[model samples]
Target: MCDEKQLQTWAKDTLSRREFGAFSGAAALAACTPGEANGTDANTSEASGDVTESSVSFETEDGTMDAFFVHPSGGPSPAVIFWPDIASIREAKRNMARRLAGEGYAVLVVNPYYRDVAGEQFADFAAWIAADGFDAESGFALVAPWREKLDADAIGRDTAAIVEWLDGQDAVDTSRGVGAEGYCMGGPFTVWSTAAVPERVKAAASFHGGGLVRGDDPKSPHNMLDQAQAEYLIAVAQDDDAAAPDDKAAFAEAAEAAGRPAVVEVYEGDHGWTVPDSPAYAQAAAEKAFADKLELYARAL
Candidate 1:
């Protein structure tokens, strides 16, 4: 969604160029460093031990879907579908998955742009920015075409296929309900995932996801709550909240009307704060968000 580009602009507006440079430098360094030495989220770091990872793919209605799968060495665990932001799957996402896997969950980090391209589109957010000539508009413009193919219906279909693949894996425990978490562009996809396989996906979380409250779309994430059996956690970016202050309330009202439990809050971090490769990475807020996600999964999954 173009809103993703707006989020980038918002981050720039909130932080001076020098400050952003420092954040980006630190994020890049942290991403390159192993474990939690660079002040990565403590929960994510604690869960980073001894997790197995692999590159895998499965057939979807759109095409072959490629993903990075990771899980603990122990017995089968609850499956978690990770829908990455606009940059698509890369080392940052894989590391995030590994951290979650260490927490005893079988994590699948999906390439949301798989329909248009296979494998990693960018090595990281920095790569994407560099490729786009460091222009926000052009950066999002490159993905705008791909976004057209990722509507709620399409994401729901993909989620169904993904859940089926996860269930068939030895690492995934089918007995326990699945969970889905999406970042940026992937956020609304989590709701679509739950709506597609309500029986399997019992929990969903959206971090700074755009298009969640598409009032005109019948299949908007807010409108699909009744179709989902899962509880939700919607973490809004501070700048995004400032731009659309009523969207959070709208989400709360929609969930209440649908009789679905949800926690919708505007977090202190700017857009992309939860992601390690983003210029807006805020360790404190990202850690809080991760803790909240683990709590949600523990309670619902």
Candidate 2:
């Protein structure tokens, strides 16, 4: 849902050039960093201090799915399935997984485009935009096919497979419930995940996610909560809320009707704000969403 217009607005008024460059530089560093001595792959490595991470792959009904798995080295922890935004799996997502892992969760950041591509297609959002010559339409065009295949049913199947894989890992605590978090287009996937395996997934958080309240789609996220046994945190970007002012209300109504607990709020940031490598990243808003995410996990997972 992030377009070139939003990118221009962010650059012109939100994030200064220096700050944007700094974030981009940090993303590049993370993406280019070599694997640690005990890392599992040449290009994938997150092992450090209290957490251990590595690139991993598993088979799904669709194809071989690649992901970044990170967890505390101390012991097994509650598992969390993280669905990254359209940029796919990259260093920024890996860093986010590490942060959640440090909070004592076994975090898995999945590449949503693995059905068509493996590893990172772009190292950061900047790279993604640059590759398209600053035209967001091109970036959208590139992923349109892959994105189309990721309907709620398809993501539900993937979620089942991901949960199976996580349960098999020694780093995951099967006794505890799993948590699900997603951004942008990945947001509705969290709802599908909870519905896929309600027995395992207990909490879900959607940040600046789109298409949550599809008009006639019976499988839309707001319409699927009746199938989930999870609580939710829906962090709507301020601009996104402005565009669809009734969506948050719709979500709240749906949750209440289903007897499910949900916290829906319009964040101060714009779309793509929660991601560190995004041009719209706002520290205060991002941190607030993070805190809300942690609270949901703590209470439900």
Candidate 3:
């Protein structure tokens, strides 16, 4: 069923880190540009031209939270809260949300680090890595303190607030159900969101997310599956899977125990492959992941 109900990886990882970095830098430079990376360009889809975007903020328990919201001019569509990766919200995220809006969904891409920062911390994924000296130790140093502030419990609260705010929007179709999608660290946020607002969020997708099934962490997202009312689409990167070969099965078993339908697949790509701005971007695999995402939303939301 991996080829049917579940999606499959599209291609092999042929690019070395250096080759991948070079290719992604060139591709992302163009793709991250406003109005260029859109999957539904103006000349391509009329819906693309119809999308309206705005920078928005609201009161969460923490503080004033800022976000980018976009949706078709058409009123009342199913809402999707997008949790960006560690790099946070930037041009790439705004463009991504717009493309999804053109597909007939109200998309809100959030700044996960709202407590420490209100806006873009780095220009892009590459910029974030470089700003911290580009090595694992240095990179970890920069995000460590920031990550500490957003524990699983804090994320659960944020998701609740985000959903409540979204429900009040004229663009959101509360009559239907909501969807949530997350990347990298945001991946587990999808699960957390579902557990937080299970009644509203009927579907969720996680791409190349980290620490979903941490053996040492008793309260891992895997353990919270039973709290969700949503079906799931968990796409693991090849490299991440290699590091923890047991996570895929662990997730599957948890979903079965929860009695929720899911599509859990390990794709042939490195971590961050699904996000175009990342040096790890793998076009073929990313496309497959996005296609599966569309399918999951169409059926669930």
Across residues 65-175, which tens digit of lDDT does each residue of candidate 2 receive? 999899999999999999998888877787777778878999999988888989889767766665555554556677789888999989998999999999999999999
The lDDT, on a scale of 0 to 1, for candidate 2 is: 0.83
**Against the unseen true structure, what C-alpha lDDT does each candidate score?**
0.83, 0.83, 0.77
RMSD vs true structure, all candidates: 4.3, 3.7, 6.2
Output the number of the TM-score-best candidate: 2
Ranking by TM-score: 2, 1, 3
- Structural similarity to truth (TM-score) of each candidate: 0.89, 0.90, 0.86
Q: After superposition, how far is residue 107 of candidate 1 from its true place, in Å?
A: 0.4
User: Can you write out model 1's per-residue Cα lDDT over 80-185, one digit (the tens) per residue?
Assistant: 9999998898767877777788788999998888888888777767666645655556667787888789988898899999999999999899999999999998
Q: Which residue runs does candidate 3 get wrong by more than 4 Å?
A: 1-25, 29-48, 216-218
Residue pairs with backbone atoms closer than 3 Å in model 1 (clashes) = none
The CA lDDT at 180 in model 3 is 94
1 or 3, which is superior by lDDT? 1
- Using lDDT, give the best candidate's number: 2
